[model samples]
Target: MSAVPQERRLVTAIPGPKSQELQARRTATVAGGVGSVLPVFTTRAGGGIVEDVDGNRLIDFGSGIAVTSVGASAEAVVRRASAQLQDFTHTCFMVTPYEGYVEVCEQLAELTPGDHAKKSALFNSGAEAVENAVKIARAYTRRQAVVVFDHGYHGRTNLTMALTAKNMPYKHGFGPFAPEIYRVPVAYGYRWPTGAENAGAEASAQAIDMINKQIGAENVAAIIIEPVLGEGGFIEPAKGFLPAISQFATDNGIVFVADEIQSGFCRTGQWFACEDEGVVPDLITTAKGIAGGLPLAAVTGRAEIMDAPHAGGLGGTYGGNPVACAAALGAIETMKELDLNGKAKRIEEVMKGRLAAMAEKHDVIGDIRGRGAMIAVELVESGTRDGAKTPDAAAAAALAKACHQEGLLVLTCGTYGNVLRFLPPLVIGEDLLNEGLDIIENAFAGI
Candidate 1:
């Protein structure tokens, strides 16, 4: 028999009777710190729809925080992971290395931007990959300091927390952070320092100058950044900013690291966002969508820099789990067969058109910015001329809640919490995509 269709099919209230019961049980069993985006609990998911326990099928725009690019339970990924499971689960790659792990690393080296001979090391999460990138950079350069950008998010690990720019939520209670981490202003032209138009180059140059004076280029080991700041409101650096930073790093003997965890695997309409600016970073940290929902991250970089660390210094017990590697291999194959990069570009085209229209109609939408499929809409209080004004988080949340009630799942993000991020699967149908966009517009209209 054919599988049940996966689309919006609301039978009961969002939480319903069963989901409410489950939520109560979860409250009793699960940790109190655990949080959720939507009240409905997921029972099944495929393509663009997530079937909640209450039988309400909500359109998935979050994509598990941009993890499942090919969509949840993709056929090839399921097949490959299942087949691999039947063969062997874990031999602890460190204890007895396997071909799957090596193969994924090889693929990463070839696929990640940078024409230089590259090497890769797999890890369990984005945080792990980022940490390893720093280790490699320090090992190679023998420097003590690392520079990160304002509104940039690397990870939650101690070291990465120090590297991360946000203070509350991500690093509020968690302290004392790792040392030798410095933060500089990002190239956000929308909120330029001097209110200058097209200030990307100036912003980058000023940041480089600060680094040279305040944190001496010679003392800096690496300059880590996200090409399109993910949690920082999906902010894409100005055209020349990244390339200029890369050039500065090269001239100053500092390793340039691109954190592509949220932007890689065709999500940004490119293999890596660094490719958009033709900036070849020395190291690229990736995760989220790498393994089609599996927990796999990687740090791929120039071979010499990656190999600078001693042999035993770089691995984890579950770094490149066999199952996850198999899923990654399948995910990569799926991207190629489906041409997800092209799909992402198409998504951008559609989203840009729709959102541009929405911006024209709604004064609350202060800005709509992003590249390819990775897009966001920053909402401000009504009648705000300056984009620099803090976003209206309360209004954005109300809109998101309304969308959820109306059978769509959208997520809000940003430093100020006013941006709504769109990270739908590249495979979502045009009809469904339009449907979700309609929900967003309707929510904004209601607000």
Candidate 2:
């Protein structure tokens, strides 16, 4: 069988005997804070399926939370990383530099938005990339306040948790977080009080006004936002919203940072989500999809702004690990060679069509949003569709459980915990894609 098989197989009940045993062991060893959606332990995963310890090959729609955009077992990524591994695992780039690090940075300069002289610093996680980006921004602008948006999620680190909006699972009890972070409204289409049509302009205007009156643009070091808010939900900002914000940052000399961690490397049918709106930021942070499932993150930006931090101010011991850098290079090559961007667009088309049909029959689907392979279906209470559009977290949860039982893997997100996000690998075949959608429809019907 290929990495992405053309069919789905069910060996036993979802969390079959083996997975159940693992689940018991995991419960005792894993921290209570750490969580997972389903209890099935995977033995191998590739293409668009995850084989559990019990031999259940589940159709994967999450793509390991959008990290494996080029496919977890992509041949190019495996080949490069394996070769690099045999040569030498870690000499530590900072201790003694490597060609892989320089080559990865070179590729980032060419691929990231804007033709301006750009430089990048690699990190091990999205949180690290985001934290470093803020550090760079503050150093460059010499300001204290950092601006984020409602329903925006940066990471779990102290500073990023301050940047993130949700308080329940992310920020609760993790208090005394990094300060100087301010939050504003995001152009969330469905939940916007006025209407979807006015959501963009209204949200943008309110955000800008709030910044001017509350935070003062002159004192803000950076205004970081996801072109498509990831964990907060796949909320694609309104049409003119991003441009307005970008222009404001330019005028104020603020370091505008686009957090493309979840939306880069052709995940949104473009090189980056900001490119969809032709809005280029002074800085861009990328991860998740960059290394074909390896832990690698980068903050790329205009050379002058990036150089704001003094010499010896950046880098970590494993910042640009040789294996991870090799994987990133391979991932980039795979994206270009296979044209995964076009595949993402096709995935979007297939998903939107099936989801629209699902919506016609199920009123719980209050909204269908997102771009390319990063699509989501917002669930709401059935009868409340004409009124407040109350969130149906229960329904979303039930549907997810139902899908898991049926050998399909789907993940839920959103501020209200009602959005079922679909992040299939770019390499997923049409048959597997449709099978997953069909499973979703059955799940909804079951609910």
Candidate 3:
């Protein structure tokens, strides 16, 4: 039913001639700061394949950084979005509200974790949602300091940059960030000084101690974290870590916020990563996969917390645009009709099975982590294993290049830039999934 052929075929080299020309033009016109993972100019995409201008079809493992969980061109999404465009594109929800906006909020309330009375406010991007979440938390608690964890990435805005841990590309020179933001250690299993088994208890204790000693818990407004660290190597917090921190926030009267931008929807096995540990957050920020490929984000949580801010205090000219809201409803419909959650679980089984075998053969793969369709391999120096390995960033970069050359699109992330993450569409075919893994294995062999 898809127009694009769901197969990997190379008519020419990776970036073929047309893509090369486009890259040259992009270099001259686009901002130097705007970077790309792959240079191929896509002409069409659907299912598991991205077809470039030169007619080469590459197996897409990134899914536009986990945005297109229902496939880039899902039928329901196209139908709803096209219908919305035909009727009306924009009335600006704030100026003249439409049912689409309220419908999306209602769906988010039902879909996101918790059965309690909940509310939501849509935004244009993850950064905007995160900023607004902080605002609502501050207003509700009447506190200042916000707590974040090491290796956590919230967004690119000033307040988010202060919350982010990585410095090089994210925070390098982007200062002075917003104030009253505090950073503490997360239970990073592979890198924790203590063993992975002990990381949860030890790290949580340390974080609580620092918050109490340095910034009084009474002064903290929110404690935010990614249930599964996205750009931070797909690190799922060690067991008990999330529950402990969440309990601390509850005991201290601080709002517990879950930054589920990259890990929400069916990207993880569950609708939300926090559901894995049954850790219910007071506030949860969602984006990336909310609207198929459209730009939509939201902060959904307790009704009281979401309504803390005055009515006029929370709105944007383009937030919850009618067209985007329509697309979101379509996406949710597709997710339910197709049972994307089960598909994500299937992807996890296939990926972990193959990756675990590869790890047995290659010591560079120090750890294979993540859940469901969102997975990753942390590359480290050769001959190292367990918790004794050193990050090998060069290896990660080289391996990614190899995968690119072979028409298998992959991506790398992490504070050290040594992690190769995979986020294939939940609709990806099982054969294509294995083929992509084969390419990765071959790349490691070549390395």
Candidate 4:
């Protein structure tokens, strides 16, 4: 049904001549700090493939960093968005509320992890949603300190930069970050100081102790975390970690927020990753996969908490543009009609199976964890026989580069830069998925 061919095809080299020219032009105009994973310039994309200007079709695995769960050119999303565009493009929701915006909020209420009366406010990016969620929590709790975890990534804004843990590209030289933000260790199963079996209880106890003794739980506004760490590598916390932390927040009257920006909207085999452990949050921030590649984000939460901020105090000029809202509605339709959550589960099954096989053959893959299409493989020094497990960032970089050259797009992430994260579109064909895995297998064999 899609115009773009679903199969990967190579008429020329991966970054063909046209892409090289475009890259040169991009370098000249675009900011140097804005990095790219693959150099090819896409002419069209749909289903499992991104067709470049050079007529080469590359299998897409990144999903524009987990934004295109329904595929880039989803039928319903395009139709609804284009219809909204023809009627009128930008009547800011704050200026004049639209039905599309209200409808999107309604969907968020129904789909996100709870049955409680929920309310939502839309935004233009994940960072804005997170920032606003923090503002609302602070307003509700009347507290100052906010707690985050090691390797957690919130955003690029001043406050969020402080919430984030990585320093190199995210926080480097962007100092004098906001105060009252605290960091604690997460129950990282693979890297836990104690064994994985003890991670859930030990890390929770340590974090709770630090909050009480140091920050004082009474003074904390919110304890926000990604149910599954995204930019921090796809590290899902140990089995009981989320429930323990959520209980702590509830006991202390501190708001518990789930930064589900990258792990929500069917990317994690469920509407939200937090549902996996049944650990509902007081607030949840979402984006990335909500609107079929369009820029949209939301902060959805308990009605009482969401209402804490005086309404006029919580809106941006372009917060919920009508067109983006329409796209979101259409995206939600596609997700339900096709059962993208099930598709995500299937992706996880296939990916984990293949990755496990790869791990058996290649010792570099230290760990493979993540739910659904939001999967990652952490690379370690090849002969970590003693299990020092030193991160092999260079190998990850080389592997990604090799995949790129072979017309398969892959992304590397993690605090240590040693994670190969795969976020294939949920609508991707199983054949394309297996082909992409074959490419990864071949690439690893070469490595």
How does each model score on lDDT? Answer: 0.89, 0.92, 0.94, 0.93
Report how far off residue 261 is in candidate 1 (Å): 0.2
- Model 4, 1-447: lDDT tens digits are 467889999999878999999999999999999988888999999998999999999999999999989999999999999999999998788888889989999999999887899999999999999999999999999998999999999999999999999998999998999999999989999988777899999999999999999999999999999999999998999989999999999999999999999999999999999999999999999999999988999999999999999869898988888889999998999999999999999999999999999999999999999999999999999898238889999999999999998889999999999999999999999999999999999999999
Which 10 consecutive positions of candidate 4 have the poorest summed lDDT?
382-391
TM-score of each: 0.98, 0.98, 0.99, 0.99
Which pairs of residues clash in candidate 2, taking residues 3 or more apart in a chain or in different chains?
A: none
Task: Name the lDDT of candidate 1.
Answer: 0.89
The better-scoring model by TM-score among 1 and 4 is 4
RMSD of each: 1.5, 1.0, 0.8, 0.9
Give the residue spans of candidate 3 off by over 4 A. none
Model 2 stretches astray by more than 4 angstroms: 1-4
Overall local distance difference test of candidate 2: 0.92
lDDT of 3 by residue, 5-124 (tens): 888999999889999999999999999998999999999999999999999999999999999999999898899999999999998888888999999999999988888899999999
Per residue, candidate 1 scores C-alpha lDDT tens digits across 1-447 of 003365677798766898899889999999976688887888778788888877888888999999989988888889899999999999988899899999999999889886789989999999999999999999999998999998899888999999888887789999999999999888886667665456677888889999989999999999999999999899988878999999999999999999999999999999999899788999999999999999999999999999999989999999999999999998998999999999999999999899999988888888889987899998888888364465799988998899888888889888889899999998887778899999898888888
